[model samples]
Target: MSEALAVVETAGTDTTVPAVSGARQFWRRLRAQRAALVAAAVVALLVLVALAAPLLTALEGQDPTTYHPALIDSARGGVPLGSFGGVSAEHWLGVEPQTGRDMFARLVYGARVSLGVSLGATVVQVAVGIAMGVAAGLGNRWVDLVLSRITDIFVSMPLMIMALALLAIVPNTFPRPVLVALIIALVAGWSTMAKMVRAQTLTLKNLDYVAAARLSGWKTWRIAVRELLPGLAAPGITYAALLIPSNISAEAALSFLGVGVKPPTPSWGQMLTSADVWYQAAPQYLLLPAAALFVTVFALTVLGDGVRVALDPRAASRLRVGTGRRRENRARAAVPENALPEKALPVKSLPEKEGPA
Candidate 1:
């Protein structure tokens, strides 16, 4: 009987372990997404570099804004600072065309601008979206109708055109990067995030847990905050992660169009804008910033996809099928590494009594 109990307990443990760890399970799921994992690493590295830009520039004793006109090669139409215009001891990525500012320093500093705008806008967008979405989802039909219509109107409007029009009216004295982020967040992000949140809230508000909370006399605010919010986190975060790259790209485009962070600020888009004029003389100048932008966007996109898959087992299965990789790894990812498989759990055998005769 004791041996049988032990076997039953072991089986129960196997079942219980999987349900216990939400964070750990999410991590295991994420680990299965190889592309997403790689993207996350790259994003982390880029962020570190962006954060360390000041330290790196200080170490090099180079000011990004300071022009080294003498370094420019006038003999070659004044495009490069050196013979090759790339990978030199003094300048890692070579100098700007005419200004001759250190390429490495500008690149690093530019990352700061790009990241700052993107991250800031994303935060605002997510917060506003979540608030409006939750409100709409949990509210009565009239409230939902009003908010949903508003969201639809915003969604129908062209974001770029509206932003451009608004930006043109704003005073130049106002901060460009901050202003851009605000415009982008207000115009582009909230609608989509709100829609997603609303859809999720509609589903979650009717769940058993929510019913339990309501039955316990929890206030509406408490129910929304405690019950629905937790359920919304996975989708909200995944959407926000995906939104970041779009925000970054938009900021860059604005800068490229010359309405962004003005000259001497050193943004990726600004660099591209300037590089285009000198492309014939030094194509490296054009390629460097473009490549950085591409990498940043790609990494964010892949990381977002990974997070989405991590939170949803169905998505993970689809990812596995699309990738056409080894099935064993995907199987491992779906299950927590610390937990033993049902077949692997130790079994205690019952002792057999020997016959007396």
Candidate 2:
């Protein structure tokens, strides 16, 4: 019996339960944050719209690039001629001023451009940051110093100024959208992520598991990949989430400044630029794109904050669960002090039961 017990114990020690993937765990934690969940849903919807932009444009049979001077209300300064203040069944949102293009079609297609640039840039940024950060954290002291200095240089430099200089110098032969994304990623992507990853790696390196891996003669790269990287995922991803909105806003600002995607590409920023002159006549033109940008950035920011809070051990306790307010109210109402006295007290049995028996 003792031998069997010993064998069982050895098996238990040798075969550890498979740990959950970082992505899976992060998702679980994110789901705990209600605001994050809602924000994620909104983000997902936006992504879906962006992905299906072409199909939706086709279904509506609206050409974003084609001019429709006939549809415009010249009386109202190029607002779409319609029943409800330039809005009609034919032209859902309205038409543009000078171009007279379908506003709705442009708006839908513009989502693709904005989301594509932001998402692509974010991916590049996070990947580069994680790689450099891990190397710096795990490498020798000299390596760490060099990488840290490089990171410091980037941190000190204003990203917009650098980007403007680069944009001006770089030839226009490059695809505008791709160039914009690449520029943002290369210029501003890695700094924050790298710092976070390095901090996490430094903390993880001293942990017992990491030390055990080192003692077992595990290769440094293997230890970094298998042990340290998993620990960095939560913080890295949370930071990446936050950085996405920043990238999106930056892209918009650049596009507004005429350094982004060229005309007819249907970017939200380009639309905003076009609407500036026609604000009084066709206010919807300005309002629609601006509102969309605001909502998108706001949602992403909130979601990112929620993710950060969810991933933080200290913040976990503060995360609200269920329909928070309602749940709290119900719990408080059901407490002993709030309940009726009779219901709160335990029932007592009468001794007269013996006489009945």
Candidate 3:
């Protein structure tokens, strides 16, 4: 028993585990995160719906904007709500106020706006933030100073109030939903991502890879594009993925405030707005849009969290951050020199009891 215990202890202390590549390990961890997988699937479904919104909402060859008197009066109009008295067979979501449009079809069409705004805004935000952060981290003293001050200014401001005011002015000129999303993104979405990118770039700028690239006469832009940016990829992707929900909420808030996508445009927020007064009578109307928004935001948050955990450089680290390499070497050093366990050495049968013999 004593020998077996000693052998078990020795085996447990060995550290001959295989080390996988960082990228492959990250992917493996991500695939294991069930919440992220489900969220990704949900987001993919929404993207598909956004792409097919036109076909999804098509009613008798009429587009979502087309107003049909019979359809409207009968709760089949392309609206974003259904009537309260009796659910319409054709318009599962019901009819809109006064217009009596088919709410289901409009809701179907509304997916395009929600997804378009969220995705486009995120893209714009990432692009602007990446440029700003790269510039700041590339050792531009004056540029860093200016951008830092700008970031601080926005950080101090109330983003929502500013977004609403801007939306009121901006949507009138640019009726395009994507453009409106882009504008909102430029104002609100860029700051956080920019700060993150700048911090990351600052850390990575002095790395040996960057030094090698510079020594090889690589241009600043090429280094940033090829070498530095890949280092930023994991965090950037995580941030951008989470940024979609914020952008979506911003669009919804704008719509709720009556400045988003104008009338006749179907949107999750618009649907909620129209149902706010009627929620007491029919709660489902409000619940639908609210639920959609909830799912979108929750999904993004989950995906971001999973990504952070999966891509964490210290995912395998049990030691302190700076002590990682030393700990790894120490672990290797702690491994047993013998391949066989001490107990497995034929258990020395008490020297075959030679004394008794």
Model number with the top lDDT: 1
lDDT of 2: 0.83
Q: Write the per-residue lDDT of candidate 3 for residues 1-357, one digit (tens) a residue.
A: 122122233655854434466677888988876777887788888788778777766642435565545543335333334346235655556555545556566666777898888888888889988888888888578989999888777657776787677766653556659656866787787888888899999999889989999999999899999998989998888788778888888888878877777778888888877787756655666777788889878887777777777888455422124666776788777887685356644545555445754
Please write out the lDDT profile of model 1 over residues 194-258, one tens digit for every residue.
99999999999888999999999999899999898888888888899889999999999988887
lDDT of all predictions: 0.86, 0.83, 0.74
Q: Sort by lDDT, best first: what order?
A: 1, 2, 3
Q: Comparing candidate 1 with candidate 2, which one achieves the higher TM-score?
A: 1
Candidate 2 stretches greater than 4 Å from native: 1-29, 73-79, 83-86, 316-330, 337-357
| lDDT, candidate 3, at 246 | 81
Instruction: Count clashing residue pairs in model 1.
Output: 0
Comparing 2 with 3 on lDDT, the higher-scoring candidate is: 2
- TM-score of each prediction: 0.84, 0.82, 0.75
Clashing pairs in 1: none
Residues 1-357 of candidate 2: C-alpha lDDT, one tens digit per residue: 112112233645754344565556667877767788898899999999888888887887786899988877777656666643356665678777766788888888888899999999999999999998999999999999999999988878787888888888888788888999999998896887898889888999999999999999999999988998878887888888898899989999988888888887899998887778867777888999999899899889988888887677466533355466897898778788836455557779976645654
TM-score of 1: 0.84
Q: Count the backbone clashes (under 3 Å) in each candidate.
A: 0, 0, 12
What TM-score does structure 3 among the candidates reach? 0.75
lDDT minimum window of 10 residues, candidate 2? 1-10
Q: What's model 2's lDDT at 325?
A: 84
How much is 322 displaced in model 3, in angstroms? 29
